[model samples]
Target: MAAAVEDFAPREIVSSRGARITVRAVRPEDEDGFHAAFLRLSSESRYTRFMSVVRDLSEATLHHATHPDATREFALVAVAGDQIVAGGRFVAVPETSDCEFAVTVVDDWQGHGLGRALLTALRDAAAVRGYGRMEGYVLSTNLAMRKLGARLGFSDGPMPGDATTRLLVVVLRGDDGRAAGG
Candidate 1:
């Protein structure tokens, strides 16, 4: 089932540099803006996020990104006026209460705390959907992301079969207690 657009609430926050940005769910109508944001990413940023050198997003990738399956996937975008400055998402792991997530912020917007905000929103949304944990693979050289993961309470370890990346996982909390994997 697809998650209704209204399922995610929009939030307004002031960045570290004092710019007000809105964070909300990614909608089908955001394809153009999303693509534009991808274009604005620096080559290194793209490589860090995708774990490879990706100069452009393919048609199918764009479609899947903007049209998330509500039951097993969730995505959000941070907008500064008409521009998408950052985005994040989580896809559920089959037969498990965990989801793998990814996040990216535009080069100009880096260090403004937008990435952290987007990630927090993603975590909250996933918990609401009953996901007990969220994880992601970060390039070993991306120290900023590793720090952010630590700040967000995620534990990290070497990714099996990949020396260039590390796996970070955060156990979500539920009403009863810590989520399943915790």
Candidate 2:
């Protein structure tokens, strides 16, 4: 069974620094807040997240981010008051029990456990959605994300044909918390 948007309810959480934040599903009305969060990211953070130097998000990109397909994709944002402090999402791979995941935290919010919170939620949601595996591409030099992924049970390896990038993967199923043949 597929999870609905409503499955992602707003829940308050405390960051590692003890800052209170609410995690919830992204909404169309959050476009401005989302954009504002993007703007708060430093150039290095933007490049690491997008794999490119993105000064701004295009209209189509914003639309897609704000309006994820409930059946094949899920997204969540961590809000600290009116500001979107971080966000994460997963997109199903066509005809496969695999999904691609991504996460981003504003410069000021990094290292405060927002990435862990968001990624853990995404992993659990993907498993509930019946996906057997979750993975993401992270720049090899981004040691912070690599370390975080390792802590969350995601294994890292070289991306074929792309040495500068690392492929991070985690099995979402199996009694041991890792599916076979993944």
Candidate 3:
């Protein structure tokens, strides 16, 4: 029997600001777009999304991230004009009941609503997959993500990383969109 999750087709979504534009989900043929979008992110933006300084990516990470799948590991891609501007993921981790999330929008797209849209898309996807919770870790310095978390109903908490360096973005009850603390 087909898993219920397979029935969900992530529809393409687009968000535009003035002459700028964005679209959701990368195509299998858009590897270069994926690579370029990733490279456009500032180091800090990358750190906030990946939770550390991403020295670089190995081939495996790139392939798995771009391949469209019905499983818990899914991605939402965003584009602006000729630029592949941003992306995020709703990832399934088998060891926990909760799914995890990460988003990266290039510097230019930061202040706009892209992050929130990507996050909302990821959160809704999690709910569809029967996940009642999601958790994320953001560097303490990345205030935008921290604030976005609060707006999206994520509870704030300290991360186990260096005392002043990391903070955890947690949404305790993923279903209700309530503020959940560490």
Candidate 4:
């Protein structure tokens, strides 16, 4: 059965640097924090994550990020005190057993393992929803993200018709037994 939104209660984790952090489902109340985190991302980070030179998060993007549908869309955020340090999410692909996933960590928090935690949470959430796989389109030049995805069991190949992009996928276990992430 698909897990409900309430199933994703807040949980705490310690980063590689030993900083305490909380990981939880993104809530409507997180709008301001999300905005702040977006603003704090470096231009290169923004471009790599969004595939564009986004100067700011638009209202539409904020809504999509914060107001995820409990079933088909799920999002997670990692917080240290009052600030969002990282975020991850997966959205079900229509008419398919796969979902698209994404993850981002604040500039100052990139090397702390928060990305792994956030993605793990996302993968668990998607599994409960019966998704068979999770995937993302990453920039071919983004070696850091590619490396992270590889560590999480994702396999990648060049995105057809787009030499600058690659598709990364991780199989998630379904009833038939397959294997899922952020």
Model 2 is weakest, by summed lDDT over 10 consecutive residues, at 173-182
Model 1 ranges off by over 4 Å: 1-5, 173-182
| lDDT (Cα, tens digit) per residue for candidate 3, span 1-182 | 01133344544454445434554665676677778777877787777677668967777777877775555576777766666777887666676657778888888877778888888877776765666577776677778888888898787787664655444444444345443332
Sort every candidate by lDDT, greatest first.
2, 1, 4, 3
lDDT of 1 by residue, 26-95 (tens): 9899999999999999999999999899999888999999998777788899999899999999898988
Q: How good is model 2 by TM-score?
A: 0.93
Error of 2 at 30 (Å): 0.5
What CA RMSD would you report for each candidate?
A: 2.5, 2.6, 4.4, 2.5
lDDT of 2 by residue, 36-84 (tens): 9998999999999999988999878888899888888899999998899
How many residue pairs clash (N, CA or C atoms closer than 3 angstroms) in each of the candidate models, in the order given?
0, 0, 0, 3
lDDT of each: 0.88, 0.90, 0.68, 0.87
Off by over 4 Å in 4: 1-3, 174-182
Highest lDDT, which number? 2
Candidate topping TM-score: 2
